[model samples]
Target chain A: MCTYRTTTLTVAGSGKGAEGWFPVTDASVYFDHPVHAPADHTLNVDLRNPSRGASARVAVELDPVSARALALAILDMLDSAPAGLVDAATPSGVPPAG
Target chain B: MTPGDLTAETVTITGHGGDAVEAYLAQPLAGPPAGGVVVIHHMPGYDAGTKEIVRKFAANGYPAIMPNLYFREAPGASPDDAAAVARAAGGVPDERLVGDVAGALGHLRALPGSNGKVATIGYCSGGRQSFLAACSLDLDAAVDCYGAFVLTAPPDEFPLQVGPLGHLVGDLSCPMLGLFGADDKYPGPEEVAEFEAALGRAGKDVEFHSYEGAGHAFFNTDRPSFRPEAANDGWERIWEFFGRHLSA
Candidate 1:
């Protein structure tokens, strides 16, 4: 079996994008723990597909698999959740972590 | 017809050495056979849970057979004593399992309601065995559920007694569909990848899926770890595969 190092990302920031979040390729990863995302923090970047160098902040809530994939892609970043985030965890489309 | 609509009979079939294997034969209550499906039980040996699985297939319009792999236990032993039954069966010597399953397939073909074509579906240990059946038995198709340790053994054990699937690589004569839980401990993503590569190397066709958030025994709804989403999706895939391969 291949060994995969587990990495955690703290939500730093939140936002909307021209297009909505694409679960398979978005920046967010999913986890079982809610601590993976903090609520009420607006994303400063785009949550949907970003033009090269463009950024947004959207809420990110990922299922366990999506979270893992996102975590693997961005190993050490944090994003803050937007206000009134009523879900168990944040959804992806949140802005990138600063 | 659904499982509730089947006319199932409980019967005992004698194995190579007077070893008796229990089985449930379910036929459609209203019509002719849609197809023949042989359901293999997981490592713990056949029990009420396995019987229920057979009924599920029967309800789908196929005549399903659930075989008791542990011949050591008398046919119809109390389902409560599963562990004892497995122990009595002496751990299913690897070499014998394939032949035994083939024997079961032969039995199914001869049944009155059955068509000559067959598909075998198995979980866990049965999953590994199902692969072997696909390789060795002249079946139309096979569905393997999270059967770990398939073709990933060390070089020294190149020929595993259980199925010897690795050795049977170039000789694989049938097509198979494999469903695995991405997070399963035994046959995790890495193992599935390697198995896929091996099949590719041997020039075999496979339809494989590794569902995220799903783990071992994902299809076993009665178990605590069952992943309903993955299981349902996998069942649809299996049904399509069987329909394509075993169709009249």
Candidate 2:
């Protein structure tokens, strides 16, 4: 089994999938779960009041090869999710978008 | 070109309907504009962060221009209103976007200190605009940071779909650097494959890199989605690619 260090990152915004932007809320979630479980791991991302908003959750283990790849995935999410798709005007929370 | 000196100026240029595009232009205070860079804004419109990006470029000795691409649309329409606009104009033809980009290029060339050699760099919606500029404009290079594609299908098209970017590769004249995240739904394996295939066929130089463990929109520092490592890598690549193709 591979050793993994997990850190939760807060993301606040509004939409469905990864395209949701315009976050009125301060949302936070761990960028990746401890997938050192050897194989693949599944983590649940709960977005507070997601309602028609974009929701995306990915579990990545910080391995030698996967580090850069995972970092790029986060960038892609930000690239696709512009600030126009969200509905929250002044959101303040760090819950995962379920 | 001064390594760190920067000059900022506000300029207005004619836009569609003769509506002026008010932009903040920046470049190294000491050098002739090595090349022109039109920085496209995110979908939410121009904000303080967007302005900061322009200044960063100016400080780097590149004449950077960030136009209000959404100035013709709603003024940062509220969340409730944004949905309606996306539903309505989201399907707008790419040709229209090309025209707008052309207008921006025209303005950049007309700047008293500009040298006319130009490149396009876009973020999010601006990413799409950057790619479109590469397709239609005679740009020297292009940097597309996780831009969505125009598959020309219905609104239900999945971000993973590859059919939309077919035309983009077909029309590309210059090399492009596509920065994406491996876990992003928009640039899933299928989409990357499609772009790779297109680049192979066109014999165009295209570099596609995906950062693992990251999700969508990770390059924007103003938001929590920012991944410092990935953003730095992408930014480094952008500068290298531009220097290789645009700089003498």
Candidate 3:
């Protein structure tokens, strides 16, 4: 089944793609058929630069459980960092774009 | 061009508001004035598997073409990347899809060997699009391979650009063949029955088969969802359906 469920957002970050590091202005998260994964469906993310060709993307397809775990791990890693280490880039009251 | 010899190539054709779009064209070696088919690729985009389907049509003596629905969004990029871009762009608009199909039909008819007959077959998301094209155009035949969202709407959170097309049943211009899996949820047995009832009420010529123990995407050979038993029988049904309507 084509899940067609998608969430897209604009982000400010640098992602290393096939060519190298490029500024990624867009992110798309969807649970649907994977391009390369062996499973029928996956939680997939694409960090991309629309100005660049579509090839300018870093993508990952993870199963639902792994995707949830990865999300928690990301929060955990951020929380464990020294106070203000990650927040130095952005002042309080402004949430991270991604 | 010999009838049995076949070749496939990428070409450019006018599409969707006269845009020059990349497309795959496969033709038998010699122009045998044969019928044509337009294959609409699944949501995975115009990838390798879809190309193989176009080639298979040519080998079976039908000239076929598949317009790269994502060419405008991600030209020269990989199929997966292009698909991502297209998906982020809110999927293909219904008007654009109709225009692309019309362009492909024109290209096929211009062939020296065209028999002036055309049919369409689409899998997954393309399945619903195939029905849309058949309803919107003067097509002779159409095959819907487990197309969802034709009779039911996706959850509101999904915001899929498509909507239920039950209202269009009155406009269908051709005979239709639907192949489905009994276990598929998107257009499970209940939805399929609703679609059939609509077709019946419209007094349209249609045939549908729902396989037992099979689920969504049962025809996708690459995915784990592939069910050989269902796919084989589905293919046989497709050939027979096309043979009846596509032949001169």
State which candidate has the highest TM-score.
3
Best by DockQ: 3
Candidate 2 positional error at B98, Å: 1.5
Evaluate all candidate structures by whole-model CA lDDT and list the values in order.
0.63, 0.60, 0.90
TM-score of each prediction = 0.65, 0.64, 0.95
Poorly placed runs, candidate 1 (over 4 Å): A1-98, B1-4, B17-19, B85-90, B153-164
- Candidate order by decreasing TM-score: 3, 1, 2
**Model 1 over residues A27-96: C-alpha lDDT tens digits?**
3321211212332111111132222222222434455555567666664333344443423334553533
Candidate 2: deviation at residue A35, Å? 31
State the lDDT of candidate 1 residue by residue for B1-248, as single tens digits.
44458778877765545456667787777666566888888754676677878887777777788777764443344442332333322346555666667666777788776768888988877888788777777888888888866765422222223333578767666788999989886687887888888888878888899999888777765655678999899989987898888777
Write down the C-alpha DockQ for each prediction: 0.01, 0.03, 0.67
Which 10 residues in a row give candidate 3 chain B its minimum summed lDDT?
B152-161
Cα lDDT of model 3 by residue, B7-101, tens digit: 89999989989999899999988755788999999999999999998998898889999999989998988999999999988888889999999
Q: What is the TM-score of chain A alone in each candidate?
A: 0.23, 0.28, 0.86
Q: How accurate is candidate 2 locally (lDDT)?
A: 0.60
Question: By the lDDT metric, which is better: model 2 or model 3?
Answer: 3
Q: Kindly report which residue stretches of model 3 are placed more than 4 angstroms away from their true locations once superposed.
A: A91-98, B1-4
Q: Which wins on TM-score, candidate 1 or candidate 2?
A: 1
